[model samples]
Target: MTQPVHPPKPRPGDRVAVLSPSSGLPGLLPLPFELGLARLREDFGLVPVEYPTTRRMGSSPRERARDIHAAFADPGVTAVIASIGGDDQITVLPHLDRELIRANPKPFFGYSDNTALHCYLWNTGIVSYHGGSVMVELGRPGAMAPLTADSLRAALFTSGPYELRAADRFRVVDRDWADPATFEAEPETDPGDGWLWHGPERVVEGRSWGGNLSVLSWLLMADREISQDLSAYDGGVLLLETDEELPSAEEVFRILRAMGERGLLERFDALLMGRAKTWSFDRPGDHAERARYARDQREAVLRALAVYAPDVMAVFDVDLGHTDPQLIVPYGGLVRVDGPARRITVTY
Candidate 1:
């Protein structure tokens, strides 16, 4: 197994490249994108430099690859941040120059469809962050979540162990970024109930792997960007979460079952299941319905663990995915899951 490299950290005044590796939603809806860029400048004290195809819709895979290459090759650009995630980043991965990225490793921050890039970094032996997209979490309506800002700040500038905390409150629904009124105040949020731990009493510390489950599944099917020897993941902490698509509990079980059947489920010593995104613009579930959805999904995960990885430590409702106050997780980096003490920590 290749040991991943931690990229050089960026200081407050450094330039961070903001590119849309997937969709160029910034061009379509500029409010959140502009807000995110402003936060990067004023709040974080870092300048954001946009790439050629960053805001251009229908950018080709090769064009996106050129942007990535440009950002990583530039000596002045200290880091790279995805504007948001979309469906076609898988195509962009093949066009990346592995040697160039390896020669100049810098932190890359994103999640969701950006899983494609995360896996690419993992294969190239460079650790990349799996949360904190510019358009979504950082550019959140009103102000950015305190927990998110804290996590991003730590991940961006430091290189050490950071304890993960559950958000006291979280939000799921998206507000219309095109509307001027949406930026007037903070989006609505609900109380967070903390994490649910399962299995025997123990702490498991290892390199972190995995991301959005659906994205992982797609990678598995495409046979791209994964290690040839599955044992590379052995004893690692598997971080998994679902997006707003809201797959059914049974579907979740089936995916886990497939992983188990492939002998992939037993490799992880612990699992960090991000809080499920229960509500979306299309579904618009009520409070009671959302609660039920989360409950059923949790149960599904437990059932899968019982069958495939009975001894593996598992934690549910982690604030790391499609939820507000999202905590950034380091992909292919160190993570400590303490089941007995009910705490989690990641090396940022």
Candidate 2:
């Protein structure tokens, strides 16, 4: 297979497509979506053009796919970003015009359920961004986190090597976007102790792969974009993370164990485990509980690695997933993980 090509970056004055290829939560919760859109213009100096289904709730898979096709096919739109992630993007995959998106390569940004799209773009030999959705990172309550803003700015507009920074403070819990007062101040954050490293000391450099762990599991079950030929991922850097659903430690292990059973774990020399989003609206745990959740999840991942990919280097909590001060990882783009120096740099 050919290496994935980084698509053209958007300029400050360019008009970008704001799409809801997933759940279209922007309709139900317009506050963050609007806030995010304002930032796209005021903060980033880019105009956001929304499609008919961009904010419509309960949009069909075919409809979402149509919007996606239109966004990629539109020459005036320099980039495509998700309004937010949803649950059933897997269904949208069958409807995507692979040839169209491949022919019109543009920067696409999203994560979580959007993982499905990232994998699709990866297979299409085009690099898409695995971060910076409209509602989450850009529409963050209060002011956008400085780290998130800086990282997203680089990912959206720049085309070069960008180093990932460990956020000193981060938030795992979420606030209700519907509540007006939620935007009064920045979401509360706890002190981040920093990333935890495991395995051998060495540098590993390769194109990045993987996304939201739960989403990847769903994709695996559906037998979608994941190559059955295990050799396809050889020497690639794995990017994995849990979502706000707060999956159990056992669940995390089972998914990795399943991947290992398929001979997928050993293909990668290094793993960049994203910071676990421990607390959620459904299960609002205290700081201690959240910390324990994070710890147990790490243990689960380590157990899987020890069993299948013992030689693989692992770094936990690099702030790339559901965590605050999110960093962007270019899906299928070059990633250098220096275990000895404790650094990670990605080509945007």
TM-scores of the candidates are 0.98, 0.99
User: What is the C-alpha lDDT profile of model 1 across 212-307, one tens digit per residue?
Assistant: 888888888888887778899999999999988999999999989988887888999999999999988889898899999999999999999899
Q: Which ten residues in a row have the lowest lDDT in candidate 2?
A: 227-236
Poorest 10 consecutive residues by lDDT, candidate 1: 168-177
Give the Cα lDDT of each candidate.
Answer: 0.91, 0.92
Q: Positional deviation of 219 in candidate 2, in angstroms?
A: 1.0
Instruction: Quote model 1's TM-score.
Output: 0.98
Best by lDDT: 2
